[model samples]
Target chain A: MMDFGSFLAMGGYAAYVWPAYGAALVILLAIWIDGSRRRRAVDQALHRLEQQRNSER
Target chain B: MHRFANPGRFLRLANRIQPWLKALTVLGFIIGLYLALWGSPPDYQQGETVRIMYVHVPAAWMALFAYLLVGLASASSLIWRHPLADVAAEAMSPVGAAFTLIALITGSLWGKPMWGTYWVWDARLTSFLLLFFLYLGHMALLGAFDDRARGQRSAAVLAIVGLVNLPVIKFSVDWWNTLHQPASIVRMGGISIDSSMQWPLFAMAITFHLFMLAAVIERMRTLLLEARLRNQRLAAFERVGTQARASE
Candidate 1:
């Protein structure tokens, strides 16, 4: 097994490999977070509208 | 398929499938990353830089696959006027654009180490750049009009017209002597990749596919809800207007 340091070094191309993976992680996380936030906001708006209709009736 | 054209039924179906998709995507990423970083061996030519392929290749595949989906959705929206098709196209474009950006950035990172430069104006690179712009154009057209339906119709037309670029992006490497390497996995002769690399690549690809599906489904659900909100507000306004006129 390679040492932790060597593995992190990525065969001396650390700069290139790490950033590639990092960008993937950041972008994927952004998609998930933004999706969840939008869904929640819209769902809340819908729920409020339903309640308002019920109260008026 | 026609039955799913109803937004309510589609939303219920999406709700059922989303949990499973999210779970599988998370699991896939775990296994995929482990295999990519540890289990896979370094390339003889590219060395550890080969690791970048695991992410780059999958993102590129999704970028293309998602565009193909947008093209199909746009066609249905235009032809059959499938109610959900417009939502599908609109929701998927941003996700597709995100993947394209990832691919471009990661490809650039890989190129610097392997190809000895950050970028080159090769056919493959240039065409892929055009794909990114096509996605941006699609999204821009979606909001360009005051009438939401008109905006959607214009975006759909752009997506359908952009279908020509899909073939160009796929064939760019073969059609020109580009610095970017040609197909290794999907070529006619056979798969050039070894079993060691294949596992991680397939794992990541599947994960990305599931992620795309889940993201698009979530976006569609939110869009449907927003549409309902709009209609309700409009109805409420008309009701108040009728009461005022009735009193007068």
Candidate 2:
């Protein structure tokens, strides 16, 4: 099992390096979630409108 | 591609594809992080600080790729007037900017330790900072106008014109003496990277691409819906006007 020190040693600047990598993942994931949610909301609204159009027809 | 040119068809495709994209993104990240953080060996010189490559390289790559996508879509919009192409191009800005921001922020985070400074005025670093501003300029130019069409047209022009910066970013290391290291991993020459670390870096890069695509598709769906809703309102207004005239 790898110890915490080795983990921290990602090459030596663990404090600066880990967070840089970590934050990239966090930001991209957040953007992904936000985008997916926006898409879902749009799709639902579009479906309702499509239904309205069909009813009118 | 034409099958997806229609907004209705596009919406259907997006709805189906989005979930799978999300799942893949999650899986990619999990696998990539493990390989990068645990599986990869430490560099003799940089030691643990080399771990920053797992994030920095991918973000930087995506930032450039996103702009290229924008330029390509802008060409499509201008040449063919493809129905929703402009919307797709416009929606890319925010996602691209977010990616660029991630790249810049993480670069800054990584630089502090490696370069011993958060930022430098070197050519490569300056050009990258310029590229980020170009993205912000595109975002602002697209929204500043009252007419949406005008805004989109202007933004597309700007994006196409801004393609010059991509080459500048690519060549900066060679052209100038910069603090930023030359492209060792992705050089046109054979991969200079060792076998141990190369796989995780490439995997994370792929993950970044898929993640970017998922975001773009989602934003495209929202733009299409917004456009459709506006059309619906206009159609409703016309119907009401005719009915009033008939009654009079």
The per-model DockQ list reads 0.87, 0.65
Docking class of 2: medium
TM per candidate, chain B: 0.97, 0.94
Model 2 residue B91 CA deviation in Å: 2.3
Model 1 TM-score, 2 decimals:
0.97
* Residue-by-residue lDDT tens digits, candidate 2, A1-57: 888786776545767876777677677777767776876786687788779768867
Cα lDDT tens digits for candidate 2, B1-248: 78878889988998899899989988998888888888988787777767778788888888898899888888889889988778788777777877787888878877887788999898888888887888888888888999988887898899899999999999999898988888888667789899899988988988888888788888888888777777887887788799899999
Alpha-carbon shift of residue B215 in model 1 (angstroms): 0.4
lDDT of 1 by residue, A1-57 (tens): 888999999999999999999999999889878988999998888888889879989
- Best candidate, TM-score: 1
Clash pairs of candidate 1?
A: none
